[model samples]
Target: MSGHGFHVHGPHDHELEHAASGGGHGDGHGHADGGAASLSGGMSMTSKIAVCTAVIATVGAIFSYMGGSTQANAGLYKNNAAIKKTEASNQWNYFQSKSTKQALAEFARDTATDDVRMQGWQVKLARYEQEKTDIQAAAKKLEAEASQWDAQSEEQMHQHHRWAQATTVLQVSIALAAIALLTKKKWLERAMFGVAAGGLVVGALAAFHI
Candidate 1:
């Protein structure tokens, strides 16, 4: 009877053993479920971060292109302004020379004593006056053209400054996006998007010459 009692489990002990085994199996299943959930969550976070990175990269590339194009345009305008200024100066000098000739012809016509000599000087003075009129018209036109070029160049430079500012902001936004991915901060990501939006607005303005 003693040996039988030692080898045979009672009903209560059997129930406890079964309960313990079932509890262990349930815990293992729970752990597996939790692990799967964690893995899924990690993948979702990574996907979001990847998307953010791609979008930020695209915006940054556009900003860089706009900034570079604006800077190039500014340089081109400056060169055009220089050419126009040089032409204007040349025209003014030509006008001055023509005026000197006209003045000399007028003085000679007034002072000539002989009839033939006075008549010849009067004809020459008339020719010089007509030439001066033509030269004055051309010089004034050239000066106006130079002034227009100067204004245009200044406008281009202003647009370039806008584009440069926009590019700087976009670059900062890209850095913030990278940091957002590392920190997994949704608010930081949103702020980065905000800065990117501002950059886009500025870039658009630059493109439109506003």
Candidate 2:
């Protein structure tokens, strides 16, 4: 066909060109969509890992703090028990004074007063002994519990450290893989995947130990 004094293409030619252009544009759009989807998935996975790491770190910190507090309490109780025992001994010494009987008589002038003072001193001595025993028992129990907590906290800390290390390696591998994905470097991607797999294995073994 001819139009405007020039040879013109038929409708089939124009349709062919349109179809070719449309196919190219569709393929490009598909590639873009795939890339976007891949990026979204990667970001989702990264965010999940970050959240998990934060939780682990927080738990480790809490356990560490609790262990420290338990140890401190154990020490305090032991010191208090020592102090109480010393005070009880001093009070007993006062009962051995040369004027002990005269002093007691003066302090308790009436029958009721004498009985009350004697009973009060006896009660004080008994209560002090009981308190000392209780403190010792409590200190021992706290010490044992603190030891257990310390062991647990140490194990957890070790696990967290291992995980942090493993995560670092995994992050590096992922970064490399991302670069590979961008550059179409199949070998680099494969290498990164292998490294990531090793990191996962190591992390699993470390967790088992913990």
Candidate 3:
């Protein structure tokens, strides 16, 4: 009455005020319930997806590192194989030199007129033959070592491939996770888990050197 107009109360005015107050409170409660439901349902899915994505990312990183390590090992083993091959080649060359020396010594012994000179040539021939034998043995040994290193390098390369495959699958899983988060599709989440499991299996294969 003081502000604008006279105020009047009907017989039902108190009930109407009470009803309005209750409706307001009910509307607030409904909104709170809706928020809680969203938290428990949608937010719950989001949290699970986030956690799984994080775990998958960590596993993918490990797989990537293992791939790199295996690749490095393969390269190192290949270098070792090359080094051994070079050593074998050197030994073979040394053996060839000894063979040439032995041939010359034999010729000298056969053609020599003096007995003392013949004896000296014979001694030289025997020494050269023994040296050739030793060098041949060393060369064969180095060749065998090179073969072993080559085999090891091949194994490492295979393992590197496995790790790379595992990492790639995990990366796909991470991509699916991002898509699921964006689209809120349960099917995408399932696919993400399946891909992630496949990635883990590949990683296991790599670990066992399969």
- lDDT of all predictions: 0.79, 0.58, 0.93
Q: Which stretches in model 1 have alpha-carbon errors above 4 Å?
A: 1-31
lDDT of 1 by residue, 30-72 (tens): 9999999989986787687678667767866876777777677
When sorted by lDDT, best at the front, the candidate numbers are 3, 1, 2
TM-score of 3: 0.86
TM-scores for the candidates: 0.80, 0.41, 0.86
lDDT of 3 by residue, 1-210 (tens): 646777877769976897777954787789999999987998888999999999999999999999999899999999999999999999999888888888888998999999999999999988998888899999999999999999999999999999999999999999999999999999999999999999999999999999
Candidate 2 lDDT, 130-160, residue by residue in tens: 5555555655555555555555555655665
- Candidate 2 ranges beyond 4 A from true positions: 1-127
Evaluated with lDDT, which candidate comes out highest?
A: 3
What is the lDDT for 174 in model 3? 94
Q: Is candidate 1 or candidate 3 better by TM-score?
A: 3
